[model samples]
Target: MTILLVEDEDRLAAALIELFHAEKYLADHALRRAGKKTPVLMLTARDEIRDKIEGLDQGADDYMTKPFVPEELLARVRALSRRQGEVLLDELRFGDLCLSLATNELNAKGQSVRLAYKEAELLKLLIANKGVILSKETILRKLWGDESDAVENNVEAYVSFLRKKLGFLQSSVRIQAIRRQGYLLLEEEAL
Candidate 1:
């Protein structure tokens, strides 16, 4: 996750950046202005509510003031991250294969292949977190909606199915096991 921290206070910004990093968030500082398309969390000591509102108007996901608790900031960032995950939709591509979330279609080399609901969800999560190791619990919660009755092996089954579909697509996107850790999406070249 990419987070933009817009704080003019040098010491506080550095401390918060460290805190965010400790929480496993990739935080970037915005000294002058926001960058292209990155999610932002603006911080300001400006008492006027307009300053906060203006930051949000400028595309910040959330805004905070000074004397704020670290826990509160972390919570807000987590909420924004969850919101982004929930609304994830776009034309996702990996290698030569492309999947259109809007159209619910998978295409490769100008040909289409059918994918089941679970298979598509699994593929989307893997593609979204590509190059990052996703734990088993994380994958299960994402695909199975945090239901306890959902067996852990369900992820394995869907992954297997996705592998077959990728084969049909003639693509090399594969779910690779990391022994005790979980899995990583490996491209044909990476594999």
Candidate 2:
């Protein structure tokens, strides 16, 4: 799961403040890395308009000043989290296949089928990490989230579901179960 880096100005030491200043200069790099889906809520004591503008421009999903009400701070965080789950409509492509992260649709060979949310996420993960074996534990943590009750069987079931969908779409790409290891996404020709 993604985490929020809650940097409070009052808690920072002099050197740390300087480091944060450097981070402002590097905001461009940080923006690209965080992308649109990652929720960034910046907490700072600096209430200047420019500082707020800079933080927002730097890709913070939301910004709040110091001395914020404890309840309101929590509300904003929850709001941001809910917003993150909203449809961004981003697409991840690999080989002949395309998976829509927002709508959970998988497409290939001019054919498409809707997938469950978990299935789409799993496909995206495999596509992004093609050729790398993803252990069951990693899958559980990523797809089911940290400290999830999901087990290896849950991963296997979703892999099975995705493989069937790939076949249905007539996609050249496929997911292979690596026994005693994990899973791999590959074209049939790569076998």
Each prediction's whole-model lDDT (CA): 0.73, 0.68
What is candidate 2's CA lDDT for residue 9? 35
User: Evaluated with TM-score, which candidate comes out highest?
Assistant: 1
lDDT of 2 by residue, 1-191 (tens): 13244464322322232332222211111232544565676778899999999998887879888766756855765576577674322576788988765577888999999998678767766865689998988777656645457788999899999889999999999888789999988988777
- Mind giving the per-residue lDDT tens digits that candidate 1 earns over 1-191? 65777877756766786687456455556643645665678878775888878878878778888779989999898888887774433566788779876564788876888787677767766776789898878777555544346777888788788877777777766778899888898887986
Model 1 local distance difference test score: 0.73
- Model 1 C-alpha RMSD vs. true structure (Å) is 10.9
Q: Which pairs of residues have clashing backbones in candidate 2?
A: none
lDDT of 2 at 58: 81
Considering every candidate listed, which one attains the maximal lDDT?
Answer: 1
Model 2: lDDT equals 0.68
Q: Per-candidate TM vs. native? A: 0.56, 0.55
Clashing pairs in 1: none
Model 1, runs deviating above 4 Å: 1-37, 40-60, 63-90
